[model samples]
Target: MRSFYNSETGAVSIYLIIILVPIFFLQAVLIDFARVKAAEREADTAARAAVRSVLSAFDTELQKYGLFGLTGEPESSESLFSMIYKENLSGSSSGGFYKLLDTKPEEGHASLTSLYTLANHTVFKEQILEHMKYTAPIEFVLEITDKLQKPGAVKTLANGSAYAKDAEKIEKLLVKREELLDRAWMETVKLKEELNGRHHTYRARITELNRLSELIGLNTADGVRSQIKTLEEQIRSLSDSISSLNGSLAAAAAAGPEAAAAIQGMMDNMRSLQDQLTELQRRLSDLKTLLDNIVKYTGLLAATKLEIVSDDEKVQNLQKSVQELLGEAKKANDELNTELKRVSSAAGNELKVFEAFKSLKILSEDDFRTYQTGIASSAAMFSGFRSGIGSINLFTNANAQKIHAANDAYQAQMDEIYQKQLVIETERNKRNETIRKEKEKQRSKIQAALDRARQAMGDCGTDQTAGSVSAFYETLEGKDGLYGKYMTLNESPSNAGGSPVYDLEGKPDTEIQHAMSLLERLGQTGESIRNELFVNEYALSLFNYRTYGREVDGSGQPKPLHAMSEPSGHKLPGQEVEYLLYGFNSCAKNRSSAYGEMFAFRFAVRMVEELMDPKNELLQAGSPLLVLLVSAAEAAVKALADMDSLTDGKAVPISSKLTNPLFTFTYKDYLRIFLLLHSSDTNLLARLQSLIELNTERTLDHAVTYIQGSAESSVSLWFLPGVMKLMNGTGISSCEVRENRCRFISRADLAY
Candidate 1:
């Protein structure tokens, strides 16, 4: 190489230079090529970053308005997009790699679309749009759907509205039940007071009769007769009093069937207990009179002993009175024996108090059964809803807890109001207070959202259907638009009177209205309010027909007649009504088809069946009330032992007979004993009142449970479905850019 450059080899060096010239020239051209390529790559990167920035703006606006742009609230899509593009373009257009005109209008242009035609929203459109220097046009399309159904905005909204309405219905039923319980509690109080008064009277009579009792022995005839006559008069008065009490009791039973049945049970116990005491008193009075008269005659005989041999007319009269009194004593003793036998008979005469107890047992048991059945369906609905809505993640578990608590609080208030002995107005008042508060909370949330929308979009009135980007896209694409079929599917149902309009694009205010509907339904809950849990309303109607013994018309509504137990053609599994009456056929009815009637009629029939049982065990032993009555009887027996003149085993037989009747004192005797033992135990009445208060509370709890369950299910059924449809279709997307990096939202997140 040194020789080639040396002047000694000048001729050879000149030839080498000629050869190197072409190589050096080629190397310089390659170097310039590398620089140009590097410039192009940098320009491409800047353009990608700028376009991505603009896309982020679009995403923000689209998210605010709902990806489908169906939120009837205005959005700042166009203005924000324009501003973001200007900022991004100006910032990235620097670095001197490419040229971009700073002039307005024709100098800068952008086309946004779902990709149907060039003429639509097109400044330019091609596989690679012309005159779009250094980059390719970026395009993205949103396709929302629900694979579960006709997944789209319209279907989602429609289902949501239906679910919301159904939830309202369930909530209303809870409120209705509370009102019914209140009424029942009031009636219970009235019945308790009346029966308690009768009980007190019977107790007093028992005490007086015991004081009059003594063993069969002897006494003066005139004094004995006078005492006997007074006793008989008192006994007759008691009988008349008892008869009047029974009449009043019957009137009390004429109240609503549910209350009447419960009240009637107490009345029967009171009556039977009173009768046992009355009979016992009558027998004891007879024995006392016979014993006193016998003692008097024996005394006269003793006094006449010294004068007996001489025939005095007075002595003859005294002798005759003694014999007559003796005969009466024997007869009285025989009658007492006979009455004791009947009182001891457990199967034939039947223990009186037990008969009343049986009715109560059956009624209470049946009521519980009804309650369980009612709640079971709603509970299932809630479970399903909870699962479904969990996926939607908009309505939270906390929201469910709050919603259920509101209903429970409303019921609790009803209990307090009823305890105040308030009437129907109290029911209305409680509803108003709770519902208003809940509604206010809903309204406040809606207001906050609306205020935010106003701040963002100015005074664009939340009906953005006209100037909205969504509308523009639809108009641009028309029948062949990417979302044309979705739009058609989401169209609203025809208007129903007094219902809110359904335009697919829900207004911001619509959320508030839905909340109001929920409160109204909850407030409207009553005895008449019915629901079909885990099934459609129409299906519930069919279930009712099968369970309630209804005949169905062609239209599938139940047609009930006055006579119940008519066989319905259909049968649902495990329904007692179906087994008894043939089948329940309708969801609701005018008179005999109601739930109260269903139970009332069945219990009434069962009451008769139990009363006819020979065992006298209908009182189905083992209750706090029964134990109290029996204990009272034992006290009476003890008091008899403490009584004057009756302690020398003279009253032992009577006490033994009463305490050990049928190997144990019968319910009748027990009831008599209870009245006598705790005559002043006012706390008994107070305890019973507590039970009465529970009537409404128990009902309200069950109702609230059902409502909450249905509400949760409805959110899944109505609200979450809309979003899920979007997730299945629109949330998933793909794009390939020939000369650009596509900037787009890859995930759909919502906070509704």
Candidate 2:
């Protein structure tokens, strides 16, 4: 008790201790307040981010609504704002205080209820926000509002905006449609090509079947079946031809005037042949009925035939090769089917993208309807490749089957013939022994007959005009001496009595004799030798890169029509069409679809100029070009006007827009005629006609050879006075044919 009373020094320490407690508590209160403030700031930041994200969802919808003076976005199946919130902030971020709030919700709720229970103390709750864990219960409302606009102005804006969107979509659709249509047209062309090829195969098959039928004797079982197959093939061929003709008619109609005329002519021809077609159809129907009846009795035919087979090595080899081919073709068919499936899947995806655009409702419903239709048609055409390939497979299989059946039938026929001979073999052998002896006695006389044969005939029968195969091919390809219409024009009725006396063959002959004749015939016509070239002026400049292909290097060729500074050099030989050129007369050229009119135009102008030149020296030399156009004033112009003629179309009268200062020229009338010819559409009828003409078909204008110092080059430059269609297996770039048997040639090789 005395020591405790001595610690008066401890009293001041107690007072200091008591003062430190309040100071410590005050420091803790400041730290906790800082925590609450920081949490609130973090929560505010997250709220802003979440609200901003949700606001973005309204842009497109807002655009639509705002433009129309609407208060809000259009109703959608899903809540855009909720979607944005989940995507942007809360659900995924799970904003716990470390996230959005300071304490766990259950813990914070218990503490807040006991310590700060009243809504009146929500401010007190923020003071303790650090103790909270999540903001889920304390919802953050994010309003995405837009400024309102005048109703009338919004309507106008919406109309403008929707129209702009629709217009853009329509434009894109139109471009796509155009591309698809082009592809469709190309596919249509390919389809036609396939059909034509099929027609040829069908023809060959029919012929082969007929030959086999004849060999087996037409009255027999195999023969009758072969005949039925041939008739069916004929029916198929007729049907295919009719389909091809329909395409041909459509193409010709769109080709231009010349083809239009050809279309009319074809229509007229069809009218003439309608009855024949009806009869053919009737015959086909009857044949089908007959075929069905024959097929129904097939079990009876199989019963009469034994298992005998032909021992012919040729047939056996062909059958074996065909079987191997069928095996390979099957593999290829499988691969093609797989590729086609992939193509189908790709097409489906493309349709989905198109449908996606449609769902936006930004395109004019009616405006793009045509595009869909066109796309469907184009898709159909492209898909036709599947059918084309399938048909080829079918044909190949049919051919293999035919070969197998024919072999079996051949064996049966041989066996039947041999069976009869077997019954009398012993008697024939005894008779042959006596006959052999008699023949041996007369063997010396046989030498005299052999000697006479050797004396009369040379070795190997060498006097044939041409190979049988070659002759047959030539006949089938329509090359048996028909001339092109260009060379067949009679101009004058008086000369219609006979053909021209030109001694020319189809080959490129450059013998000294032919050169002399051509040189004399085409000798410098009047003023051509006196022609001068203005190499330094614009005269030659105009033709520098021009496609005249005419050698103007001091040659006696026609000067390019564009060398306008020198007006007196003859025009493209056409009287008024002096500037129209051969190479430049492209159907692909600006404002033109064909060059045949250009050819006829050249012919007409040259003819008129020749007659009216007042300076043409060729008139005295009995000019052939002029003679060919002797009826130019009447028949030539009439031919151009006639829809049935294979040249060009009628000329139009030159109007005001096309009036020229040069119209006052002496040949202005002919110029007007030329203008009319150029303006008029000349369809591909003439070119197609020329292209399909046979090699032996005499050309209208130039002959096969031209003078190059007597060195002839085989070229088919079809742009001159005598261009003709190039024929198969002969052109410079033509592919070689590889058939073992004689095959008909086609003129589709006329690319040049």
Candidate 3:
């Protein structure tokens, strides 16, 4: 055998045994390494699956609270791993490699020994030891012990070591990722705080707007009241002046011929003044009409102004409130930004951690390549988060600009309204000044006419004309005057006594002179009567007197009275028939013929009655004529009184009604038709009110529908479904896969 062993063939056989046997053993060791690698891949795959499930659950919870994707940070790999461990390994059936170790094992013999003891020996211990010598100082013992325990123990142990290293690297990266997630959560909280503050400010602004609306209506009401009061005072002053004038005119008629002439001249002057006063009054009435129109327009403007001003104030208040709220919101945004920066920093650190894992020599190139995919995915997710924050800021800026534009438009409209109001005020002042000047001029002319009439009456002897004047004056004083006498002459004496006349023209000469003196005194009483007549006539003309019962001739001129006729037969006892007849005829034939006829009839009838004997038929005949004149005068006074009462009744109620802008329009219509023969604008106020009511109702309905719909619609509805789809499809790939080896193993094992 030695010779054979020593031979070249024998030596070749020994060499072949040594080389082939070792080669076969090496192949077995390699197979074991492959099994170990597969186990590690399986563990990593399981861990990753578990971790991903937990992350998905967390994201769902965040979305439920409207906080999903608020922060720009990717899910941490360490957090993912920890969540998987807690969920899948913390309970029953928890006796895996993870359960065997009380804590993560350090790189030492104790960790190797523990794993080796648990694995036992089922593989070629000597070969495992040889392979292990190249890896760790204690790897020889660990590999041999692990191979002896079970048939698959050596492979499982080898694979578990690789998976454990992969998991450790993933865990380190996950730790940094967890820091980023924490920062993102803080940022989301800050942004939410800002939004809440802004909402509060908006609410306060709405309340202020409501208050401003009420103030506008109140101010308009006050302005209208002041104008109505000024009109009432002017009307009252005119009425009092007219009353005084009537008293003076009665006394003047009792004076003699010279006094009557003086009174006639004064009356003419008074008539002229009345014409001027009437013109002024007409102008005033026109001013009142214009004011009425202004009031109507102002009231309408006030209503709209109230609404607009209130809305504007509210918007401004809301802006201020919102600004304050935005300040809080900005703080929150700033905090969010800070948190984002922190998250970015943490995420970057995590990326560094992932990079550190990538640099590990223990991982195969293929495993490292899978790890790179996960790190890239995480980085991409952080970038997407930053993009989302930018979008929110853009939307906020756009809303602020829109609010500012609305405010500018409202201001421009207000300026235009103010300019129009100034023009109206200027016109009103000029009109008032002209009316005041005309009134002063009319007062001066009337006073001079009254003074001349009083002096002329003093020239006539009081006693000489007393009897005729007193008798005539007595008949005039009776209620029914001449009409009562005419009725008395037709009736029996008993009936005549009860009629409006009782024995006309039977007074003494002294009494007649006293009556004439009284009439003459009216001319000297001053221009108050003339001024009143002027004002009343002017007012009538201004408001269109012809429309209110003034008789218009064929020529379209106002003819207040038509014909005047004189009484021709009698004269006073001491007076010439020629003088009396001529004086009466001349007065009757005057331009103001009706007024002249009235005075001449009274004077002639008085003279004829005084000259006749009380028992004669001619004297009795004259008595009836005197009675008729007195009755006519009484009827005239009664008609005038009735007119005064009518004026008062209509004026009081109408003035009160004018206080309300809406009611003023209605009153104006009624007055124009009843007193001026014209109608006012129709039902304008009611139409406006109806329109406002209808608009309000429609707005309320629309608001209700909008509110209800808003509640039903989800906030997420505003987010396009396409956006979610894009994020789901592309964003997931950007997230880290911390346990690639474990994931590979599980996929491999499950492969059919």
Model 3 Cα RMSD, Å?
A: 61.6
lDDT of 2 by residue, 97-213 (tens): 434223211111110001111111122122123212221112110000000021122222222222223323343343343333334334433433433343344345434443443
lDDT of 1 by residue, 1-752 (tens): 77565657477787899999888755654443333333333333433443343334322222211111111111233333334434433223444532322211112233222212111112111111221122211110011011112223222222223323322332243334344444444443443342334234323432332233222223445666677667677677767767777776777777767677767676876778587657758775775757664655444434333222231233233323433433343344344334333334534333233233222211133443333232233223323333332332122344434434432332343334334434533654574465555445544543443343223211212322334433433322244432222222223221111112111123323432332333233223232211111011111222222223323333556445331112222222212121112111211111122222222111222222222322333134322122222222233223322221111111111222212211221111212222222222122212111111121111111111000000000001112223233333453422111121212221112111
Write down the lDDT that model 1 would get: 0.30
- Residues 675-720, candidate 3: write the lDDT tens digits: 1111111111111111112222211111110000000000111122
Q: Which stretches of candidate 3 lie above 4 Å from their native place?
A: 1-401, 424-428, 443-460, 465-486, 490-752
Evaluated at residue 162, the lDDT of candidate 3 is 28
Alpha-carbon local distance difference test for all models: 0.30, 0.29, 0.30
Off by over 4 Å in 2: 1-151, 216-752
Shift of residue 566 alpha carbon in model 3, Å: 18
* True-structure RMSD, every candidate: 42.6, 50.4, 61.6
lDDT over C-alpha atoms for residue 32 of model 3: 36
Q: Residue 235 error for model 1, in Å?
A: 32
Worst 10-residue lDDT window for candidate 1 reads 705-714
